[model samples]
Target chain A: MSTSTTLEAPKSGTWDGGNEPMKASYGKLMMWFFLLSDAFTFGAFLIVYGLTRHAHTPYTGEAEAFTFSTEWWPIPEKVFNAFPGFHGVDLPLAFVALMTMILIFSSVTMVLAVEAGHRMDKKDVEKWLLWTILFGATFLACQAWEWTHFIVGTDEGMLLPDGTTYHGASMAFNQYGPPLFANLFFFITGFHGFHVFIGWTLLIVAFISTVNGVYHKRGHYEMVEKIGLYWHFVDLVWVFVFTFFYLI
Target chain B: MAHHIENDFQQTAEIPKPQTKAIWRTFFILVGLTALEFLFAFTMDAGTARNAIFIILTIFKAFYIVAEFMHLKHEAKSLIWSIIIPLALVVWLMVALLAEGSYYYESITNYFK
Candidate 1:
């Protein structure tokens, strides 16, 4: 019923800095607490988006008028293209879907690495951590490609009847949907892509540390556990993004 | 003392026994579930039905991820509830906002016409 009840402190434990009253280690517990607050922040953004979508006035001009149809979020398929080689091909956010899978699969590898660390298998930890890093990097690379595709118009710019060139990432919407949708799309997903970049950097650091015998010397791989928390958090955020932005 | 230290090092060097087949079985089940999600996404049209299915499948995926991968299922009941209850708040907030927003939107559209 109360916030305190929801956030009830973990059990008291010997490692919990005597008098701290929490059973979990300071670092691990802090990660959970941080994720909890971050979750609320994202929740607010999504709720506002829902509110805005409800307020949107359907564009009901001529068939050629700039607007969205009920079919899909107006021309999401037209706006998002894969790369240079695929000119005029309608892939419809295929690249973003791939990026989502990469992140989710990396989360799998991260958990495996954490499990290895728990069992004190340094070599297994290193292997899986490396795999996690590779997946993260792949995700980052795909995002970069997506960004470039967004900024650059397809082979020839999409020409409207009025002859105004419609860049894929334009501030104007075509028959597909609202212009604000594109603006919000770039802003929100770009911000998330930045987080993915940071996550990749952190995983690289953990990977290097494992290779250099840092955790082996420390007698425990709590560092790996901490990074695993971060990696999984990124994946969790993507779950929301995939649902709200793409599927919903 | 030196002999005892050597014995401890030897024990540490020995690899721990692998987990039973149950772990791999669970992992394969997760893979199958993921494949199912993909199949639904590709085959289904975007509508209320597709959205409902996506939501259900995503929740299932998340449950497995949290329970098995994150080890929450094995944790204390209190700990598990601590994570679940807050997340439930988030989902509730999303649903409420969407419903209210859609209602207001409909009212405004009707007023303009």
Candidate 2:
């Protein structure tokens, strides 16, 4: 390696998101590139979560001395454990686990849809697309329910001396952790939920086009493969969110 | 012109039929990893070691998704690095931000608590 290197711009044979030297289409490559940038944004938000969580450690000297204080961070299991149709039941991480399964299953359906597209089978593509949309919708519904319960927090929050309570989840506070906890939760989960909705709508369009025999006339399912890339990328981000936000 | 365009489309070679079994295998691996994460979560208390394990498993799932589901593993090396290198930078960003943020957290707690 030399410290001083001459710089030159190549006049030919360059790949700049448009070139096909990678054997992938421009749209597919761009989608990957865009996801890469999106990953950084989500990563930054999670890092902020880590930062705030670290700041709010509990008093850990002795049992008698340690009393409930406003600064201590809330435990994960204690914060999120309510399941749908289970009134006041304690199911730690069970419902979120179900949400994870739904999301992962949707990813599988998406890949199958892409596979059908590869085989130029419009009927199978439409079938798989429908399944993917259903799974995505189900995941969204679960998230909505989780959010509702989160805001309605089953935990009866203590009254602050300042005449307000840290109930459920809000910008001001939550019974969970510090004030920042609720903010980070809403930002990260809300962003990921928005992405799922986007993918779901795109999939709807792909399904409709497949039903109209559009790929049949075109003799290819490039559209399906392209959308598959996006869908898979969304699933990949959720893996991180699941780990950092929910499980960990 | 329409006939010419259709003829041009045919000239481009297409890959073999869909690989459904391969995807099923990927799905099983993802499910297995998730199950392992849950097992760890339930068995172990929240500590540095558990956090490390969670991060590693999460990254493994991320790799599987990118390489297998996104098909980047089969793509050209240059293309793979073009995306991978930037993603690595994001990891670096995490380290940097977390370090500074931890410092701030320490200072605040020391003063207030």
Candidate 3:
């Protein structure tokens, strides 16, 4: 009885040997830690990108139009100057802005779904989850289009060191700035896009489970909460990627 | 067997009341910050000052997403600190590696010259 009371004495404290140490459930706590580690993974990628970029000299030419040069780092706005359905028009950062809005809106929808789940409103949860999924898929489609445009070169191809003109970007060649530019672009954004794909799939799973009355029967919607953490983390990473890779 | 399964499905914790107002407010804040980023992208010159501004804005956006959208703010203090404190290491990594990168750049330029 004395030992039991001793254990109970610390019941309200964080390390009280309670099931919830940090006032979060076991699954939610695990999810938070997972995201923390995931943040490190993304942090490493962006840092490596920054490190490589620091190695290059900045472009200092006075060119009005986009030109492929291996002498210095290409101006980002010059390289990414195409908007969908606007052929031959020089619109920089517009498409990525649209992409950002799509992602942010999707994140809002995801949080709304979590909010609905808190109230045990299954119909509302399902509706918002569907919206989030739609937005996610739309964002993925935009990424696909962006990648295709990047791979299909602009009118003026870059002159390679070997006396050949390279039009598109690959693992070994990039018309934009340097080969490392394309490599990092593919690595960082590809990894991020894969995260979006996984988040989308998870949303679908959550949606299906909601439709099947899983959360309704289970008496709580912590599943939605856990997945919401992941979805928001993806959005958060993109904010940095947009700033570091595109804006600056 | 049925009773045991039913017991497993019990609610784990109390669900807080819905904060629809705050959610919409956060949405608008995010949109406003993004608009500001776009404005700066065009209006500001490309240099260290502009990059600093972008980094600050990005951090603000990240805060909103993690604190509000992910509901980290409402979580326990210990949990919040546990996540934020460790992320300081990332800042250290950035400082150390970016310095190394610049050193490499200097090495190449100095050697060739």
Question: Best by DockQ, which number?
Answer: 2
Off by over 4 Å in 2: A1-19, A58-69, A159-166, B1-18, B111-113
Return whichever of 1 and 3 wins on TM-score. Answer: 3
- Predictions in order: lDDT: 0.69, 0.81, 0.89
User: How do the residues B1-113 of candidate 1 rate in per-residue lDDT, one tens digit apiece?
Assistant: 23345335523787676453544554566557656756776676556787788778767766766677666677656556766688788878888888888889788769779
Task: Find the 10 residues in a row with the least total lDDT in model 3 chain A.
Answer: A1-10
The sequence of per-residue lDDT tens digits that candidate 1 reaches over residues A186-218 is 766776777778878888888888887677767
Candidate 1 displacement at residue A100 in angstroms: 3.0
Of all native A–B interface contacts, model 1 reproduces a fraction of 0.38
Models ranked on lDDT: 3, 2, 1
lDDT tens per residue, model 3, A1-248: 35553334434655656457688898999999999999999999999988998898877656464477877888888877889899868898889999999999999999999999988877789999999999999999999998988888777778776887878788888788888999998999999999999999999999999998788788889999999999999999999999988998
Q: To one decimal, what is the Cα RMSD in angstroms of model 2 from the true structure?
A: 6.5
- Segments of candidate 1 deviating more than 4 angstroms: A1-23, A57-72, A75-84, A155-161, A170-176, B1-12, B17-31
DockQ of each: 0.41, 0.57, 0.56
- Decreasing TM-score order of the candidates: 3, 2, 1
By summed lDDT, the worst window of 10 consecutive residues in model 1 chain A runs over: A63-72
